[model samples]
Target: MRDPWVRGLRYLKGNLFSCPPQEALAHCISEDCRMGAGIAVLFKKQFGGVSDLKAQNKKTGDCAVLRRHNRFVYYLITKKKASQKPTYESLKQSLVAMKTHCWENSVASISIPRIGCGLDRLSWEKVSVIIEEVFRDSNIRITVYSL
Candidate 1:
Protein backbone atom coordinates (compact mmCIF):
# COMPACT_ATOMS: atom_id res chain seq x y z
CA MET A 1 0.00 0.00 0.00
CA ARG A 2 1.28 3.46 -0.81
CA ASP A 3 1.55 6.01 1.93
CA PRO A 4 -1.71 7.75 2.59
CA TRP A 5 -1.59 11.50 2.34
CA VAL A 6 -0.99 13.01 5.76
CA ARG A 7 -3.83 15.39 5.11
CA GLY A 8 -6.22 12.47 4.74
CA LEU A 9 -6.12 11.90 8.47
CA ARG A 10 -8.11 14.19 10.75
CA TYR A 11 -8.27 15.03 14.44
CA LEU A 12 -11.41 16.59 15.80
CA LYS A 13 -12.54 17.74 19.21
CA GLY A 14 -16.05 16.35 19.67
CA ASN A 15 -18.00 13.24 20.48
CA LEU A 16 -16.77 10.31 18.46
CA PHE A 17 -20.26 9.21 17.52
CA SER A 18 -21.24 12.72 16.44
CA CYS A 19 -18.98 12.56 13.37
CA PRO A 20 -20.48 11.60 10.04
CA PRO A 21 -21.13 7.88 9.99
CA GLN A 22 -18.16 5.73 9.13
CA GLU A 23 -17.59 2.05 8.31
CA ALA A 24 -16.15 1.12 11.66
CA LEU A 25 -15.67 2.13 15.28
CA ALA A 26 -12.36 1.16 16.89
CA HIS A 27 -11.37 1.22 20.53
CA CYS A 28 -9.01 -0.28 23.08
CA ILE A 29 -10.13 -3.02 25.43
CA SER A 30 -8.60 -5.39 27.95
CA GLU A 31 -8.27 -9.15 27.79
CA ASP A 32 -10.15 -9.49 31.04
CA CYS A 33 -13.21 -8.02 29.42
CA ARG A 34 -16.43 -6.31 30.22
CA MET A 35 -18.31 -3.80 28.10
CA GLY A 36 -19.61 -2.29 31.27
CA ALA A 37 -18.68 1.36 31.44
CA GLY A 38 -17.51 4.38 29.53
CA ILE A 39 -17.77 4.28 25.73
CA ALA A 40 -18.03 0.52 25.84
CA VAL A 41 -21.48 0.81 27.31
CA LEU A 42 -22.62 2.98 24.46
CA PHE A 43 -21.08 0.55 21.98
CA LYS A 44 -22.91 -2.30 23.64
CA LYS A 45 -26.12 -0.42 23.32
CA GLN A 46 -25.53 0.72 19.76
CA PHE A 47 -23.84 -2.21 18.09
CA GLY A 48 -22.85 -5.34 19.98
CA GLY A 49 -25.68 -5.63 22.47
CA VAL A 50 -24.95 -7.32 25.80
CA SER A 51 -25.35 -11.05 25.23
CA ASP A 52 -23.85 -11.11 21.76
CA LEU A 53 -20.74 -9.18 22.73
CA LYS A 54 -20.21 -11.23 25.86
CA ALA A 55 -20.42 -14.46 23.88
CA GLN A 56 -18.20 -13.15 21.11
CA ASN A 57 -15.62 -11.91 23.57
CA LYS A 58 -15.48 -15.29 25.20
CA LYS A 59 -15.15 -17.12 21.89
CA THR A 60 -12.75 -14.76 20.18
CA GLY A 61 -10.35 -14.07 23.01
CA ASP A 62 -8.76 -10.62 23.34
CA CYS A 63 -9.18 -9.22 19.86
CA ALA A 64 -12.91 -9.47 19.43
CA VAL A 65 -14.21 -8.48 16.02
CA LEU A 66 -17.90 -8.33 15.31
CA ARG A 67 -20.21 -6.99 12.64
CA ARG A 68 -23.50 -5.79 13.98
CA HIS A 69 -26.30 -3.58 12.80
CA ASN A 70 -24.48 -2.84 9.54
CA ARG A 71 -21.33 -1.58 11.25
CA PHE A 72 -17.97 -3.06 12.17
CA VAL A 73 -16.88 -2.84 15.77
CA TYR A 74 -13.46 -3.79 17.04
CA TYR A 75 -12.35 -4.41 20.57
CA LEU A 76 -8.59 -4.33 20.40
CA ILE A 77 -6.82 -5.65 23.41
CA THR A 78 -4.45 -3.13 24.99
CA LYS A 79 -4.04 -4.83 28.35
CA LYS A 80 -4.01 -8.41 29.59
CA LYS A 81 -6.03 -7.80 32.73
CA ALA A 82 -8.42 -5.27 34.12
CA SER A 83 -6.11 -4.29 36.99
CA GLN A 84 -3.17 -3.71 34.67
CA LYS A 85 -2.39 -0.59 32.67
CA PRO A 86 -2.37 -0.66 28.89
CA THR A 87 0.99 -1.19 27.23
CA TYR A 88 2.32 0.80 24.30
CA GLU A 89 3.60 -2.31 22.53
CA SER A 90 0.22 -4.03 22.80
CA LEU A 91 -1.51 -0.93 21.50
CA LYS A 92 0.88 -0.75 18.54
CA GLN A 93 0.41 -4.41 17.73
CA SER A 94 -3.35 -4.08 17.84
CA LEU A 95 -3.29 -1.00 15.62
CA VAL A 96 -1.21 -2.87 13.06
CA ALA A 97 -3.63 -5.76 13.14
CA MET A 98 -6.52 -3.36 12.83
CA LYS A 99 -4.94 -1.77 9.79
CA THR A 100 -4.65 -5.14 8.17
CA HIS A 101 -8.23 -6.03 9.03
CA CYS A 102 -9.48 -2.74 7.64
CA TRP A 103 -7.61 -3.31 4.42
CA GLU A 104 -9.04 -6.77 4.03
CA ASN A 105 -12.55 -5.52 4.71
CA SER A 106 -12.13 -2.48 2.44
CA VAL A 107 -12.99 -0.21 5.29
CA ALA A 108 -12.25 3.18 3.81
CA SER A 109 -13.15 5.22 6.83
CA ILE A 110 -12.95 4.68 10.58
CA SER A 111 -13.52 6.64 13.76
CA ILE A 112 -11.52 6.01 16.90
CA PRO A 113 -11.19 7.62 20.28
CA ARG A 114 -7.83 8.49 21.87
CA ILE A 115 -7.34 4.79 22.57
CA GLY A 116 -5.42 3.72 25.66
CA CYS A 117 -5.23 7.31 26.89
CA GLY A 118 -8.27 7.38 29.15
CA LEU A 119 -8.96 4.78 31.81
CA ASP A 120 -6.17 2.57 30.53
CA ARG A 121 -3.64 5.28 31.49
CA LEU A 122 -1.41 5.19 28.43
CA SER A 123 0.15 8.34 27.03
CA TRP A 124 -1.73 9.95 24.14
CA GLU A 125 1.50 11.27 22.58
CA LYS A 126 2.89 7.75 22.30
CA VAL A 127 -0.37 6.17 21.21
CA SER A 128 -0.95 8.83 18.57
CA VAL A 129 2.50 8.28 17.13
CA ILE A 130 1.92 4.55 16.95
CA ILE A 131 -1.40 5.08 15.17
CA GLU A 132 0.32 7.22 12.57
CA GLU A 133 3.10 4.73 12.10
CA VAL A 134 0.68 1.87 11.65
CA PHE A 135 -1.91 3.55 9.44
CA ARG A 136 0.07 6.21 7.59
CA ASP A 137 0.72 3.95 4.64
CA SER A 138 -2.78 2.54 4.40
CA ASN A 139 -5.25 4.12 2.00
CA ILE A 140 -7.78 4.72 4.70
CA ARG A 141 -9.32 7.78 6.30
CA ILE A 142 -8.84 7.92 10.07
CA THR A 143 -10.63 10.28 12.38
CA VAL A 144 -9.42 10.67 15.93
CA TYR A 145 -12.07 12.05 18.22
CA SER A 146 -11.83 13.80 21.57
CA LEU A 147 -14.72 14.40 23.95
Candidate 2:
Protein backbone atom coordinates (compact mmCIF):
# COMPACT_ATOMS: atom_id res chain seq x y z
CA MET A 1 0.00 0.00 0.00
CA ARG A 2 1.13 3.53 -0.66
CA ASP A 3 2.24 5.51 2.36
CA PRO A 4 0.18 8.48 3.49
CA TRP A 5 1.63 11.84 2.53
CA VAL A 6 1.36 15.29 4.17
CA ARG A 7 2.69 18.35 2.45
CA GLY A 8 2.16 22.09 2.73
CA LEU A 9 2.35 25.04 0.41
CA ARG A 10 5.74 26.77 0.43
CA TYR A 11 4.12 29.99 1.49
CA LEU A 12 0.77 31.23 2.71
CA LYS A 13 -1.23 30.84 -0.47
CA GLY A 14 -4.39 29.33 -2.02
CA ASN A 15 -7.96 29.23 -0.85
CA LEU A 16 -9.16 26.19 1.12
CA PHE A 17 -12.47 26.31 -0.77
CA SER A 18 -10.67 26.13 -4.09
CA CYS A 19 -9.83 22.47 -3.67
CA PRO A 20 -11.81 20.05 -5.82
CA PRO A 21 -15.21 19.26 -4.42
CA GLN A 22 -14.29 15.59 -4.04
CA GLU A 23 -11.69 16.41 -1.42
CA ALA A 24 -12.74 16.93 2.18
CA LEU A 25 -12.10 20.21 4.00
CA ALA A 26 -11.08 20.48 7.66
CA HIS A 27 -10.41 23.23 10.20
CA CYS A 28 -10.36 23.72 13.92
CA ILE A 29 -13.32 25.11 15.80
CA SER A 30 -14.36 25.21 19.42
CA GLU A 31 -16.83 22.76 20.91
CA ASP A 32 -19.37 25.57 21.12
CA CYS A 33 -19.30 25.93 17.29
CA ARG A 34 -18.37 29.59 17.40
CA MET A 35 -16.47 30.37 14.22
CA GLY A 36 -16.25 34.10 14.75
CA ALA A 37 -12.75 35.03 13.61
CA GLY A 38 -9.79 34.29 11.41
CA ILE A 39 -10.28 31.88 8.51
CA ALA A 40 -13.02 30.34 10.62
CA VAL A 41 -15.23 33.33 9.86
CA LEU A 42 -14.98 32.45 6.20
CA PHE A 43 -15.74 28.82 6.97
CA LYS A 44 -18.82 29.82 8.90
CA LYS A 45 -19.97 32.11 6.09
CA GLN A 46 -19.42 29.45 3.47
CA PHE A 47 -20.80 26.38 5.24
CA GLY A 48 -23.47 27.82 7.61
CA GLY A 49 -24.36 24.71 9.59
CA VAL A 50 -23.91 25.95 13.14
CA SER A 51 -27.05 24.29 14.42
CA ASP A 52 -26.23 20.98 12.79
CA LEU A 53 -22.73 20.95 14.22
CA LYS A 54 -23.88 21.94 17.71
CA ALA A 55 -26.46 19.21 17.47
CA GLN A 56 -23.63 16.67 17.38
CA ASN A 57 -22.64 17.65 20.97
CA LYS A 58 -19.01 16.93 20.36
CA LYS A 59 -16.58 17.72 23.18
CA THR A 60 -13.12 19.09 22.93
CA GLY A 61 -10.76 16.64 21.22
CA ASP A 62 -13.54 15.22 19.04
CA CYS A 63 -14.39 15.69 15.37
CA ALA A 64 -17.73 16.97 14.11
CA VAL A 65 -18.70 16.40 10.50
CA LEU A 66 -21.01 18.12 8.08
CA ARG A 67 -21.90 16.52 4.77
CA ARG A 68 -22.17 18.75 1.73
CA HIS A 69 -23.15 17.01 -1.48
CA ASN A 70 -20.42 14.39 -2.09
CA ARG A 71 -17.93 16.04 0.23
CA PHE A 72 -17.48 16.29 3.99
CA VAL A 73 -16.39 19.21 6.10
CA TYR A 74 -14.55 18.26 9.26
CA TYR A 75 -14.71 20.55 12.29
CA LEU A 76 -12.00 19.53 14.72
CA ILE A 77 -13.00 20.39 18.25
CA THR A 78 -9.69 21.45 19.70
CA LYS A 79 -10.94 23.54 22.57
CA LYS A 80 -13.90 23.77 24.89
CA LYS A 81 -14.91 27.32 24.01
CA ALA A 82 -14.05 29.84 21.35
CA SER A 83 -12.79 32.33 23.91
CA GLN A 84 -10.11 29.93 25.16
CA LYS A 85 -6.98 28.83 23.37
CA PRO A 86 -6.35 25.22 22.39
CA THR A 87 -3.71 22.89 23.66
CA TYR A 88 -1.51 20.67 21.49
CA GLU A 89 -2.92 17.60 23.19
CA SER A 90 -6.52 18.44 22.34
CA LEU A 91 -5.54 19.23 18.79
CA LYS A 92 -3.87 15.85 18.43
CA GLN A 93 -6.89 14.09 19.79
CA SER A 94 -9.12 15.88 17.34
CA LEU A 95 -6.81 14.92 14.49
CA VAL A 96 -6.98 11.29 15.56
CA ALA A 97 -10.74 11.48 15.53
CA MET A 98 -10.70 13.03 12.10
CA LYS A 99 -8.29 10.41 10.83
CA THR A 100 -10.61 7.69 11.99
CA HIS A 101 -13.51 9.33 10.19
CA CYS A 102 -11.46 9.54 7.00
CA TRP A 103 -10.57 5.87 7.18
CA GLU A 104 -14.13 4.78 7.87
CA ASN A 105 -15.62 6.92 5.11
CA SER A 106 -12.91 6.24 2.48
CA VAL A 107 -11.96 9.87 2.34
CA ALA A 108 -8.62 9.75 0.53
CA SER A 109 -7.73 13.42 0.49
CA ILE A 110 -8.39 16.33 2.82
CA SER A 111 -7.56 20.01 2.58
CA ILE A 112 -6.92 21.94 5.78
CA PRO A 113 -5.40 25.12 7.01
CA ARG A 114 -2.75 25.06 9.75
CA ILE A 115 -5.23 23.84 12.30
CA GLY A 116 -4.84 25.25 15.84
CA CYS A 117 -2.14 27.56 14.62
CA GLY A 118 -4.16 30.48 13.35
CA LEU A 119 -6.49 32.18 15.80
CA ASP A 120 -5.99 29.43 18.34
CA ARG A 121 -2.31 30.43 18.50
CA LEU A 122 -0.68 27.04 18.74
CA SER A 123 2.74 26.53 17.22
CA TRP A 124 2.70 25.16 13.68
CA GLU A 125 5.88 23.15 14.23
CA LYS A 126 4.25 21.23 17.05
CA VAL A 127 0.82 20.99 15.46
CA SER A 128 2.26 19.72 12.17
CA VAL A 129 4.15 16.96 13.91
CA ILE A 130 1.01 15.94 15.75
CA ILE A 131 -0.98 15.80 12.52
CA GLU A 132 1.68 13.80 10.74
CA GLU A 133 1.96 11.39 13.64
CA VAL A 134 -1.78 10.83 13.86
CA PHE A 135 -2.28 10.10 10.16
CA ARG A 136 1.08 8.54 9.30
CA ASP A 137 -0.18 4.97 9.03
CA SER A 138 -3.20 5.75 6.89
CA ASN A 139 -3.40 6.03 3.11
CA ILE A 140 -5.00 9.45 3.25
CA ARG A 141 -3.20 12.40 1.71
CA ILE A 142 -3.23 15.68 3.65
CA THR A 143 -2.99 19.02 1.92
CA VAL A 144 -2.17 22.00 4.14
CA TYR A 145 -3.45 25.26 2.74
CA SER A 146 -3.09 28.93 3.66
CA LEU A 147 -4.45 32.30 2.59
Best by TM-score: 2
lDDT at 131 for candidate 1?
80
lDDT of each: 0.72, 0.86
The sequence of per-residue lDDT tens digits that candidate 1 reaches over residues 11-102 is 77788877665568888766656656667677666775545545655322245677865667788877766667767887887777777788
Error of 1 at 15 (Å): 1.6
Clashes of 2: 0
Question: What TM-score does model 1 achieve against the real structure?
Answer: 0.82
